[model samples]
Target: MNVAASIADFETLPRLQRARGAGRIAVGQIAGRTRLRTLFQEGCAKIRLPRPTGPAVEAVLINTSGGLTGGDVVEWQAEAQAGSRLSITTQACERIYRSSGGAAELTTRLRVAASAHIDWLPQETILFGQSRLERSLDIELEGDATLTALEAVLIGREAMGEAARDACLSDNWRIRRDGRLIHAEATRLTGADIERDASSLLAGCNAFATLVSIAPDAEARLEKLRPFLATLPHAGASAMGERLVLRFLAPTGIALRRSLQPAIAALSGAGSVPRLWTI
Candidate 1:
């Protein structure tokens, strides 16, 4: 079957960036100062923004029809100005349906300019067994810009007695500042690997997550969050100059979510957890 995709942008001035693919790849702009929106019946959708500032840009993704069944691909891009600040969020959790043939992929790109900031706080991603998924995030930033991101994955529904015994999952993320790579990570999970060594990969865990922050005060932020980070049964941290990486592994999805809340609040300085993630 041919892959399906779509792209949209919420720009308001010197022309925006937009691209989508559905068995075909297309690239274009939304034009700055123009507010644009599109509805996707099926296939992949992408949103791009350039030199954005002031009011934060928002996107609401709804799977109105139902869960994704076929091979669907989705991508998103957001770019901010030298002193702009932007926040990108999803209206709801992304649901991955059982794949009939190949897996689905979601790619996101974020670019921030000097002294700018971007917050990538999307809802959780639910995966069904027999499904395959690959998600990639690329962030490019200028000096003194800040980027805070979160990634959480649930293998299967415990209450439903559903387990991803034969499923496959892959996730990758990369962050660059001033054209220099600063952070990179990749995770791949399959049925055989999980069964063979559950402890090492899943650690008898059904869900896990990672939070990465890059800023001038990343070290201090890491120190402040040390107490909370220490509470995790399995956690790790590495810092240099203005960047800190944090990872968490839990036996249950609830546990993982519980541990992530305080850490995110402390680091992001948000009054409470993101509303979209309450579910």
Candidate 2:
């Protein structure tokens, strides 16, 4: 069957998408407004950002594909205007299903205007056996804009006694401010080879998370947050210029999330947390 038909059939097949296989793409966006306070848009659907106090505007996208085909693509984007605050989070862990012979790709883009703030917080991505998934994220910021974002991945479901015995995963991230590149990172992992290089790749941990923040005085803030990071069990941080990067290697997703909260609080200064995270 064709891809679209396959997806429809899989959705109706009940156990197929969840048990054996499937591919899906979801997109969402939230913006700050004068009268409404905030606004949200998803794929063609729109909703007014609910009022009351909350962390910046936030959105989440999930891919339910049991695996990817030769031409599968997923895309997401977000933008925050001057003086506006927004935070985005994923509803659940992303699942990259087993692949037969093709590869899957996910691309994300974000833009933050001057004096605006944003938190791009997404849940972990879980890769099943024989899964081949490539993911990329790009962030563009106006001078003086601030951003804090996190990306986490788990190689196989350790809780389910699964290990990345035969999986290919590639991830890339880039951040730019005022058209100047500030940070770039990339990683690729596959099969037992990745596990053999565990010491250098992920310190032998099945779960890992990276948090990055960009601001005018990000270096100073990173230093201030360093002391707080030392309080976490398995977290470390580094800073360069207006960019700060933090990494956590843990045995489970809950541990990784716990390590991330305080770090984000220290860097963002907004006591508010993303609501999607609580769910």
Candidate 3:
């Protein structure tokens, strides 16, 4: 055997990278337009804003750490003042690498005042084989406030011929409106269970996304964006009461994004997504 032709597999001595950050923005009406009043940030999480245009304010969030692995902790928080209209998104998709120890944790907390509108449209989260990640999103909304949030997940990369069959993921969400619980959901998937029911639960797809909107006219937007969903395969769009949820599965990350852009644009009512999304 030629020694030079063989590669080393040393999982025991992997390099460790850790970072923590948080960001907050309080927006209020200035000359009848949304404007940031107070902003605070520390650690790995951040929020960047663009020049004022119209009454809606757009923000871009960043994680300077690039990616995360086991034993890492990151926190994100935001606030939307009453009558403020804010839309936020990540600079890029967040990636989680394989780990051998504790799982990475990402906790986000958001508050929306009465009559405020917030759009939490972070990009996707890609997981690598043997990766363990736990994330939770908690939102508190005042009465009559509107919220539009989207989350996407990619399990491994098909281009690399890799499968996240050994990864573990736990995603949780809790939402409250006017001090009353409105929606609470949790999804847990383990490596073994994923491999066992990949075909059934995942529907033979490698990536999936969900978009939720809560507003007085949330149900009406379903008909407005239904045509876009019709253009994609393995997609579902529905509305109940004051909430609309759009879910889709695709064989590749590109396809899922292609299917989501139009839906997000129409529902967010920004005429387009954040500037960093196209980049």
In TM-score terms, which candidate is top?
3
lDDT of 3 by residue, 1-279 (tens): 655444344434566667667777778777878888878878787778878555678878888888778888888777888889888888899989888798989888889898888889999999999899999999999988988888899989878988787878899988889878887777676876654356656776778888888888877889888777787878887788887888888888888888888878887746576667778
Cα-based TM-score, every candidate: 0.76, 0.77, 0.88
Candidate with top lDDT is: 3
**Residue-by-residue lDDT tens digits, candidate 2, 153-237:** 8778877888776777789999988998889998777676646345666666777888888877878877787777778767877
Ranking by TM-score: 3, 2, 1
lDDT agreement of model 2 with the native: 0.68
Better of 1 and 3 by lDDT: 3
- Lowest summed lDDT across 10 adjacent residues in model 2 is found at 18-27
Model 3 poorest ten-residue lDDT run: 3-12
Error of 1 at 211 (Å): 0.7
Q: Residue 182: error of model 2 in Å? A: 1.1
The residue-level lDDT of candidate 3 at 143 comes to: 80
In order, how many clashes per candidate? Answer: 14, 10, 4
Residue-wise C-alpha lDDT for candidate 1, range 64-121, written one tens digit per residue? 4344444666666666665554555565667777777767777777777776666777
CA lDDT of each prediction against the hidden true structure: 0.66, 0.68, 0.82
Residue 43 error, candidate 3, Å: 1.8
